[model samples]
Target: MNDMLRQIEPLIPALRRYARTLLRDRAGADDLVQDCLERAVNHWSQRRDDNPRAWIFTILHNLAITRLRSSASRPRHIAIDDAQEETFARAPSQEDGLRYRELLEAVARLPEDQKSVLLLATVEGLSYAETAGVLGVPIGTVMSRLSRARERLLKERDGDRGAQPVAQLRRVK
Candidate 1:
């Protein structure tokens, strides 16, 4: 058990990073990582010594997927702070913040599966094979989804209703 904790200790940062990317919020991501580590600690004694890293990763992946699925069934809405919104609205540089807002909205528009793959690959810096393992998909599928994700992001950012005109042009062009 002590050896298992020692082995799993190094995975905490990686787990937190992956969780943050998956959840897109610091508090939610930390909760997810905490949940994952708790599960890992509870199950560590039963784990085989062959590949602990893969085992922990699999647990985290499963938890994130399950939560995402659950969240999908609900209506999507951002819980913006009214006060902050009002303050920002009154700010002189509101235009700059609008671009940030638009980009975030575009990201929110992505399909969950594509977002997951993109986050796993880019934010987590997982290799193709590693992402495939985490996503339980073929490497080819990972590549295809990643390509599609990039394409969709470009389209969203470039559409007329997207962010500021100059920023959209810079992104699309």
Candidate 2:
């Protein structure tokens, strides 16, 4: 329907962004978004009208979880082309770029639950209630997971800073 298109069209970018953060791979994220769109279209009649954003997100999140779980059970195999592509990947050269990469690595190190909560809340700009609805968890659980995620990231940042050598002053008098 035209009404459905009008509503869903505006949400594609957000869905793609959320999918990218969830999967950590651009191609996989795009595929997941496509699958989610397909599923959403097929189930449009069943979805509650009160919150289509949350509903769509819920569908994507569930599909992502299923994909992640299934993938975890299988051994990972990188194709020769993919491995060769990694050799050509650019490394961070500037201090800001390095810091940004480190931040991303730190986020990647977070437990899946905490990472999901953090991404949905901060990266996707979802409120606690909306995040909880998408994740199918209590709002309090979302709050706690987000709190723990922030604490862990802070600790990781502090640890990285502490790992660097500090310059000591020499007595030159």
Candidate 3:
């Protein structure tokens, strides 16, 4: 038990980071992490030791899905304070800030599965296999999702598709 805590302690920050990315709400993310720890501690002794990191992540992932589903059935609300707290950028100019915000919105708009894979692999620095185990998906699926996620993010960051320039006509003589 003591050995387990030592190993698990290091992963908490990473877990919180991943949760924050997923939830986009600091309080919600903290709640998810708290729920994850509570569940892990409750089932600590019975859990398999082969991959404790994956197991704990799996718990966090499952709890996030449940919350997302429940929230979907109801109207979503974002407190102004939480939204302000979520931004990490200190913009040099308003244009840069706008671009940064757009990029973040693109990420938040990502499909949940792809978002999870991208955050787990890139943000959390998990190996492909570790991500697969955490999400219970195949390695190929993780690769595929990650690839698609990057492509979509790039596309959104590049342009506003279907946007057209407006034309003005001078007054006729």
lDDT of all the models against the reference? 0.77, 0.89, 0.86
lDDT of 3 by residue, 1-173 (tens): 78778878898998899888888878899999999998998888877765688889989999999998889889877666657733655655688778877877888999989999988899888899989988999999999999999999987765665376758788998
What total of clashing residue pairs does each candidate reach?
A: 0, 0, 0
Clash pairs of candidate 2?
none
Cα lDDT over the full model 2: 0.89
Pairs of colliding residues, candidate 1 = none
- Runs in model 1 deviating more than 4 A are 1-7, 45-54, 71-101, 161-173
Candidate 1, residues 104-152: lDDT per residue as tens digits? 6676678877877887787666788877887789999999999999899
Write down the TM-score of every candidate.
0.66, 0.85, 0.79
- The top-ranked prediction according to lDDT is 2
- TM-score, candidate 3, is 0.79
RMSD, candidate 3, Å: 8.0
Comparing 1 with 3 on lDDT, the higher-scoring candidate is 3
Could you give the C-alpha RMSD of every candidate to the true structure, in order shown? 7.1, 4.9, 8.0
Candidate 3, lDDT over the whole model:
0.86
Candidate 2 residue lDDT tens string, 1-173: 88888888888999999888878877788999999999998999999765588889889999999999999898767666656564567985899989998888899899988998998899888889999999989999999999999999999889858788999999998
